[model samples]
Target: MPLAALLERVSLTFRRQSVPAHSGVVTFDLGPATGYPLKLHLSTWQSDEPFRWESEADSVTIASGAFLEPPGIAWELLLATEGEALLQGMPVSVRKVIASAPFLGVELAQVCGQLQAARDLASTSPLLLILLVDRASATGMPQADFAEWLTQKQAVLCAAVDLPASKATAKLLSRCTLRPMIRRELLELKRCLNTPQGTALLRHHAPLCLEHFIFLSHYEGTYWPGLLPVVDGILENQRSQPGQSVWLHRQLADIEGMLGDDRQALRRVMSLEAFQRLHDRLLDHFNDQINQVGRAKLASELRVQYGGYPPAPIPGHEDILPITSWEALLQEGQRMGHCVGSYHKSVAAGRVAIYHLRAPEAVTIAISPQADGWVLREAKARFNEMPTGDAMRRIGQWMDQLTDT
Candidate 1:
């Protein structure tokens, strides 16, 4: 269905009604008549005080704000549903004003002016009309255009919207450069935009590198958030010097291997040369293990010393065992044709923990500490192959147990 028709069916209504003396509130209602029932209530008193906002649906408060705060529940809900185009079409200037002046106080004039600017732009971009009406009605602001509205809003767009020119931005000259992005993608983009390297890449117009960066950023298997700059730097170098033997295509998997179970270790790595040195050392160590009997004896001794450090056995998986020693790592790596054996130092330092599943399939699992809890870094069968469906299901059940505990 057309976005306009969808919105009409949603039956969005906004009211700026007087409450008691010395106070006012803006209420937005999406009723069951439209199939999307939501109630947003905002209360404001004096100009110096912050406004409060809350969202309710089905007779329950889905979200609420503390004193003087404007909860993002309204915007988030809009973006999650059919109102995305309206929000995405809004100029950044208008968005900033709405966020800063939720109560329509000191910035009321500025807010109205931006809304008028939105009105002026709506002729050329019809979606802006929907956005303009939404904001203007919600805040009870006038929509007639002022002479300076268009020029001022244009200046804000040019200054703040420095994202690289792409097909997405090419058409949205007056709207947010990130207009095509959804909420989660916007969050990821914000993370990169805060960093100098990421900003540089975006502003410098490196589409190829940006494409690779986006791909790696969205990959859930690898902890790629903090390592975005590393990927950007490598891609930049590759672009500048194509003759270099950089593993451009396989960089993600290779970096994951180098990371082992301690993905955060990338932060301490000061330079590409330092990363190369660690990679070389791991390669050398993996190549040196040749004697199986010697490996077994060393595994026994190390297990005797560090066995208690491993996490308790996975409850129902009697065939699974935690790998607690360098010899065990080597054996797993040799059998799996992977570089996990080099993770002994990380395991010994308690930075990473490895688990081996011995039944249904010989799979090696690596879990590492993330922000608050453990995360599965990677799970692979022999020869660096992906585990079978049943094996993965079992691994997932074990991970769920870990979370429960």
Candidate 2:
């Protein structure tokens, strides 16, 4: 049968099972009526605890392998029936978030024009701007954009709800520590739509909601509800204190570190020298054990430059100094790119500046500080290939011969 035909068959079956319409409209279980077979998931999509009380419907239901609402349009899901063809129901969409840092300036731009036209600016409605970021990468482009906007015009920070490992965001507000009023709203999103988190929630009845406080919960999986609430609360508190972007940036750093994606954490800071220090430490971490052909050559080059093998960390110096792990180097290098600086002494030796590839994802290339230094590196004299400067030198030599004639 065609996919549409199969879905229609399922939809008709679901509508038939739905509670009948009332006088004008029947009192119905809207949850089942909206979609035939949506599996509820933890709001954050990654929680492993008991789900919120709201996920406990009369029974978990699935049709054609999907845990969905009855009478609602069917959706394609990556669901597998665990056993008995249809899967059992579980706990679902429950979450919370609190702004962790002072965030009053977040939405200033959106409200700026509105505030300008108002008779009493202070009396005008206070709108909140909530920002969320995926900690998967070191470059916090989303968070940084939000911070820049806030810096341009300060605004109130609304509730920052962390999404659980579940794939929920707007719905996770119920889990926010700062506001209980948003619970119904967050839950309603789950009930209305069979989100992936909702599917996970219904299939696996675990804690769908959680407080978004950094360092509050242990190092769990990537479900993010914990950090948002702290950010939300911080924003709420910062409303009274204008101009606190620096503090806000600092807080982001703290949360990024807590999640073990410290590369992102460090990028949130404005300092330039941190990466240089990071470079030194990363070299020490692997203790010169560069095994691969590519990495081994890079290591050999470093040995020639630094002049010795790196010693492993001692007990006394270990805690006092930052851990120079490869992970850290990769994270920082990915964010900043390798630190390129002048090799003044090396330039005098006919070499260009030293190009340090701090992250594993980079290649080191030497650039002489002198203008002609690049030509020498690109010349066939250095390599067998017809390098860029080789043709240029031939053209120049021809010009000289013509002038001599």
Candidate 3:
């Protein structure tokens, strides 16, 4: 059967029903006219609860879903399993039509029309056609210009499928215009395609992932052979972490912020472990210097302003002194090798108060206002280690005294 005729026979209807708790159900009806019609129902929630789905076909219902699978995999799985019986003898082009229906939305008919028109193009690979159709649908390129657009994108489209088929590849192809620099990077990625590191880079092409790849490309001559592996390691480590791109972007931005024009220093990073260690060391040094300067200024201002934190009631074994200025907090953190120095904002905002215990054993304490009164949020000794039992007891007694007063 011709691709267009096959698509005509394959009917699809999409409807989204909104309900309470910000939950919704999306249904896709495929080939309702065909005796063996398939219906896929997806139940989505605003909470962390997993998505649930039900697939009904030929009076049999298969219900299953996953928390970890990417957003559209459920629909694809339904089509591959139960819908396969209906699509048995259909051309792969027809199969792509059914698979892309839910995502293509209103553009399904237009995309199908464009696909039929472009069938005579040099490369009509099903994968390439679906990719172009997706891109066209997203960009709203008119049918008149689609042929020109397809011709222009022909080289990149062909090259994209040469790499692995993954969400990353789709994102890279659909979102990015193949500029000279990006094309160069793509070619280099293709060269390493067979290796584990190369395949990983292809698979995990998040925006920050691409930016990191481009950033490393600048130092390619210096880091060669090891650069891709470093990238792969970073991606692998970040894969399990949520908000991976956000985390990666912040880390990279910090490096750029700390080093500025010192590309020479960045060139020294040769491995993923080394990259992470450098980021840590740079962050610590940056925070320490900034905190020192900020604290000194804060202390000078606090001294002039005169109003100070309320004095802590000294117990028998220990003296609890309120940390009235950023300078004192910085000293506490520096001496303890902990992050109390970073609490300057919270202290200034009056959300929390800090104190230092001078006797029995030095401990830094944080107390926040609660419904009743101030409560100890944390008490830590040097290096954020747990304080001794006696030290905690003294602190607790001081808190009780403060509450009573």
Candidate 4:
């Protein structure tokens, strides 16, 4: 109901103006707001002449089917102001282009541009997030040079697509280093895709998806066409592979044995072991079927699909961060609780530890550190449901380990 109510009205008109398409701003009654002069970064979809011209007509449809971000915003009006310059006769979805915001655009320039401004500069957010950039942009850094010479600490490099994005127009994606968009904002971005150009523009909004859902390195291979089946293949491979799921299963079994759930636990162990053998036998077949079909399915969508983990190694916990012992970790966590108590909470109240997963491919481990050793309470499975405390509880335990070691 809120969504329908929000899209109830959408119209655009054109007028002569010094600015280009911006002369055609659409205004909606999404209610009033505390106006903040957010200097937003935006891009547009160019339409053929008649549709563009009709867009400036006094009245047209702002269909509910179209998508917008900041969902209901009188703020969308700032992106456009109706003008008399009309091009063609078709509907245009005036989507707010999303980018690293607030501190993006001129705000960041001013701070980095001046020496005095740079001296007083600091960021307020925790876990300085980073901008996604091309491999070349990041590799340009010298081995010994610290990144602080570039931007704030909270700023991080968003992962890059292993493939070259554009024949030429790809730099925006390759060079983008920072943007702050929430789930709702992403929804808004997707909604705009219905217009002929909306889908193309929408992809520009979320290059991050290019990293996960895409392929890299080579083209021309056949592609897998379906999402669910690909998921099934990934699961099957995990079941069969000696690495990843296999390792986790072995670990889970030992814990189960400690807890006396031997039968079911043993069953899991055997199943994975069997799958691993089958996978090895069919390894050639699976790779052929999956890669050919998968690559084709994703080909047009992604510039280069990842083939056999490709050449570039991304920084993930290939190996866990080294710490001497769990006890040292706990002490460090307690110190964190003291320093940033408001942002963190200690679930270390007792012997019980619970790890709840927040998203796909991530796991939370719960533990309590002692003077020299530590205790494992509950380790949540990968990407289950994220209870509110799930992430923080897991991180706190991690912090405890860091401190203790």
Candidate 5:
């Protein structure tokens, strides 16, 4: 029998069976209008929790009595049914409703290619494209491939009338985060869709979207030259106050770090005068550390001699200091003929800053206050035996040992 004929004959209805709290059994009774037999298999599909399903004749009872059924299990069961035997042409209204459903794109992924190909005859090309994009988003792609797809999809969407506010685009943007793996793809999307008009649309739809923020922060000047102007334009156009834009400042600092000009990046985004004050504050902090350690020594002596309620408690030095830029230190090293490569902070929550220098070695610098001052509390280099010119220079200069001024 044709699937369409089978579906036309059967009617599905639900029945409640008694059970405990958060548990129940629902019977699906498929009544054949012609008063004949029907056979259906109840197999588990993708499940969030365990469930028992049994089928007899034209009826099935799905039990969640053992454990509570997940929120969408019933719905999944209906959709996951292997009814290729009963599957046929859906009503125009049903197809439209399914097309608009949030999970429709997700559902499309599980359907047999033959079923999809059959549907292609009935579904519009644009609708299929929309489904394809959504499927692509739900199941990720290679970074390079995803970027290219996003670029092309964005262009198609630009000219598309029916899918102006596409769910696919929404899902993609929402899923994008400041993660290393997806950073390139997100950046590509931003570059493709973030025109002046596009930015306006984005600002209107997603005013505080993190994707834009992440893209700006991770931007590599070496890879995307002259992109700062684009970022500056976006920030300037926004109604947000510059002073209160912590994300802007932080991301700009990050981009600057990538560009090997952290201070310059900070200056462009933040006030140069403010950074100068911060530099002075940093110097003062080191001076204070030196004074505190000396006083600690004196207090130790007093404990031995004229011990009196331990002299005014010295302030503990900050473990992580963001007061000064790393580029400043690197520039200082460069001035002294120490070849510096790209720098990276410890990915873990530690105050260890690592520098790659021409000396062909990784210079690990730890920041802390010692008895003397806020010096390079600890410095070590993991040198390569066969060093490059840059590494050889840095090794010979031995600039890893930058101490307190």
Candidate 6:
């Protein structure tokens, strides 16, 4: 595919650069192009002393992976050129590394420097960093503020164990677990378990596995811990605790709803009339909108265009050609054989209007007057699958009430 098309589809930016010989470091700035930091390093060395090198081999490193955006075509291209450098007598390797989570247990600067070193080594992928905290470190800091601070970091997850439950620390743990993540990413940013007891607690509560599965099929081996039966001993034990069980049920219901398992979601939230009604309303609205748009194209009175060629209405409605002005709204309505009325309402921003079209039914439109043109906001009408001129005036009473408002 063309580069422009690829970039547009994947939301990626591409760039390339060369590192001169003897240069110690090379870095690229990819401001906001990436969600996570990317690091790439190139090193050159010579094993002069056969058995082992008496001194460390001289190397130049390229460190800037954090900036690489999606579908990293440029990075792959650059990495492929490593053989050219190797053939030049200097043994060289290109290392690609994923940056560590921004926040760590240790001093921030020192941790970053260590991560940078690891990225340059070409021995392993970027490491996952987990913070270890003792009672003092966990409690000495204001629990809520520290938790919030951790939450705001780019890629840090926290876990607190059997330590005396402070409200803030508990909140922090909740925040970490509740934050949505693909199973693989969740494992990557896996939070620290402060104590050995934390492990036992995790295993016991592990049955409460509510994961959102959007794109984990490829990484299922790494992310999918075997699924558990919905009603096993674990759920049965959880049922007595209303608060905990209710939250877990709701989470499961949400996942089911998102996965298009409406029947399952309804079973989970049967008592909550509002939940059922909300989902019903949403589905109904979607169906109505789809039907309306389909019918509109077949017998639409107004011809509109944001840009490009306006789509055809229908064979009989071909005369409904594109119009470019607010005046055309009424003219088109009349041509379509409807009683159209419009009035402007004054506002601080200038003037806005409500345009009414009385046909088989009445439609109301909200129009905002822009400097160069008018923009239609809320344009809606209850239209039928097929309509005729006489049917437009058949519901005169309803149309009159709609026009009055």
Clashes per prediction? Answer: 2, 80, 0, 58, 5, 6
The candidate scoring highest on TM-score is 1
| Worst-scoring 10-residue span by lDDT in model 2 | 78-87
Q: What's the lDDT for residue 150 in model 2?
A: 38
lDDT of each: 0.49, 0.28, 0.51, 0.29, 0.35, 0.31
Tens digit per residue, CA lDDT, model 6, 183-278 = 244332233233333323334343332222111111111111222223233344555342433333333332333334344333333223434344
Global local distance difference test of model 4: 0.29
RMSD of each: 12.9, 23.2, 15.6, 21.7, 19.0, 18.7
Residue 102, candidate 4: C-alpha displacement in angstroms: 15
Error of 6 at 332 (Å): 41
Q: Which of the two candidates, 1 or 2, achieves a greater TM-score against the reference?
A: 1
lDDT of 1 at 75: 43
lDDT, residue 123, model 5: 45
TM-score of 4: 0.21
lDDT of 2 at 84: 12
lDDT of each residue in 1-405, candidate 3, tens digit only: 322243355443332322342334445564443345655555432223323455666656744333222223334443444342323333454444434334432233233433444443312433345545555554656666665555644555544336454544444434332222322454343444424444444344434334344444333123234445556666667563444433344345446656655756666776778877776676588567756677677556644654454343232333887875556766777787656665545566666778888768888888878876788867778755568889989898888887787
Best candidate according to lDDT: 3
Over the stretch 322-371, how does candidate 2's per-residue lDDT look in tens digits? 21323332333233332221122233243432222222222322322334
Per-candidate TM equals 0.46, 0.17, 0.37, 0.21, 0.22, 0.21
Please identify model 4 stretches exceeding 4 Å from their true place: 1-394, 397-405
| Tens digit of per-residue lDDT, candidate 1, span 1-405 | 332344455444443323443344445565543455666655432222223455667777777653222343344343334332224334554454344323332133233333455434543432222333334445544333322323544324322334333433322323322233232443344344334454443443433332333443444334333344455566456654431222332334455565567766555554455555555555445546435356777666656766633543333358678875566677777777667775655676666788898878989887878877777767778755668888988888888987899
Query: What 10-residue stretch in candidate 5 is worst by lDDT?
Result: 63-72
Better structure of 3 and 4 per TM-score: 3
Give the per-residue Cα lDDT of candidate 5 at 311. Answer: 18
RMSD of 3: 15.6
Q: Model 1: what TM-score?
A: 0.46
